[model samples]
Target: MGEPSHEATTAPQEDLSSEATTTARGNHAEELTGAAAMFANDRASQHLGITVDDHGPGWAQCSMTITDIMANGHEITHGGYIFLFADTTFAMACNYPGSTTVASGGDIDFLKPTYVGDTLVARGKEIVKQGRSGIYDIEVTRGEEIVAVYRGRSRTLPARKPTTSDAAAPPVPTSP
Candidate 1:
């Protein structure tokens, strides 16, 4: 496994925080739209300490820290966690107001091993979006090095009337 380079002395968290604030200010009109709302209910991602750093109509960036619990038998960060981070970024990029997009398929390639204490950032961009179908590419990186790449295909579901079940379900909790 390749070790993380210590030459890059920049603080990843500070950079992400500033970027997130800038993105939010620039896209204030779309803030209450798709990705924000969907992420509010995304307990899985939240539980894993995944943070949606920035998101716009066709792009998103997310970050996560590899914890000891996420390590595999080989003592590296598990590939599935990387995939999930990429997939979450992809979902944020594709969905918009009035359209609920879902991943039809996805593929990921792991290029390097990550270990505990590493902060991984995944950036997703829309390669093409036509009608109800779209394609997105996500790149996961640790500091300045690329760790993984993901490609995802998405389909937007047609709008439907709310059913009784929808009304009966309880609201998703915002906190524990």
Candidate 2:
């Protein structure tokens, strides 16, 4: 992987399909969410509009838009979509492989007003984790300027239940 372009108003890093992406970010393809990850999407995005970008921890990034469902009375953007960007990326970073995480709480600062046709991106990095709780430093960046920074927490699950795959791998045939 080479280095990802550090730019403002950037498009989705092309088709990021290469296992060895041309980005400084190390490959975490194994952690990529398929249909298995919880919260695959919310009813708001219309279509599934969330994805992980080529980034490393304690750093992560995601992109979402100001859809009709996400616009406010003024036909501008809303806070929920902003939270969506933040929370989604945070989930990817915390729920990684080892941690089964849920959002404990968060604080978001809205720096500037957003409008329709704006493509917003959110980024999060795990700053610290201990026991069953961790703090994530988050940034909601539009273009190059950061519109918001969220401090979020992931509360660990006591004992997570088996996923479909975990339970569907048929038991080994018993030999008499």
Candidate 3:
């Protein structure tokens, strides 16, 4: 393989704190709508170690570190972890503004299988927003090599209840 394809993003990288803040507070998994629940299926990524930097309507980026737990018997990083990392970024990008959006489908391009200790970063950017649906391009990279690529589709719904900082706008990109 060449490299894993990723969900592309224009997100600026930052020094993420290990102590995760409650990114979503209003509804836990059980309390979420179906769409929200699906989008929220990214708990493992967040629980393990995923950082989401969302800039509403414009960009979203998430970073994940490859650890021993992420490796297979042969020592190559498990592809599931990579997929989750990319998908998690899509969730944050779609859920920015704290709205409920569900992905309809996606196309992913995997470039290569990575190994432990590699810092994989996934970034997502809005491609276009129509009446109630939007498309996003997601990219996953390790340092500089592109590893994975993903395209996500999300369907938005009117808010049932908003999360804390629901209306927050996306921050502009600074640097990785």
Using TM-score as the measure, the top candidate is 1
Which sections of candidate 3 miss by over 4 Å?
Answer: 1-24, 27-42, 161-176
- Mind giving the per-residue lDDT tens digits that candidate 1 earns over 1-176? 12221211122233323433333333231333467656655668877888877777788888899999999999999889999989988988887754678999999999999999999998888999999999999999999999999999999989756677756756533433
Score candidate 2 by lDDT.
0.61
Total clashes in model 1, counting residue pairs 3 or more apart in sequence or in different chains: 0
- Candidate 2 regions exceeding 4 Å error are 1-36, 39-48, 55-58, 161-169, 172-176
lDDT of 1: 0.76
- lDDT of candidates 1 onward, in order: 0.76, 0.61, 0.63
lDDT of 3 by residue, 1-95 (tens): 11222322222232222111122233333233232333344446656577654334435667777888989888988877887777777766666
Name the TM-score of candidate 2.
Answer: 0.66
TM-score, one value per model: 0.75, 0.66, 0.65
Q: Top model by lDDT, which number?
A: 1
RMSD of each: 10.1, 8.5, 10.0
Q: Least lDDT summed over 10 consecutive residues: which range in candidate 3?
A: 14-23
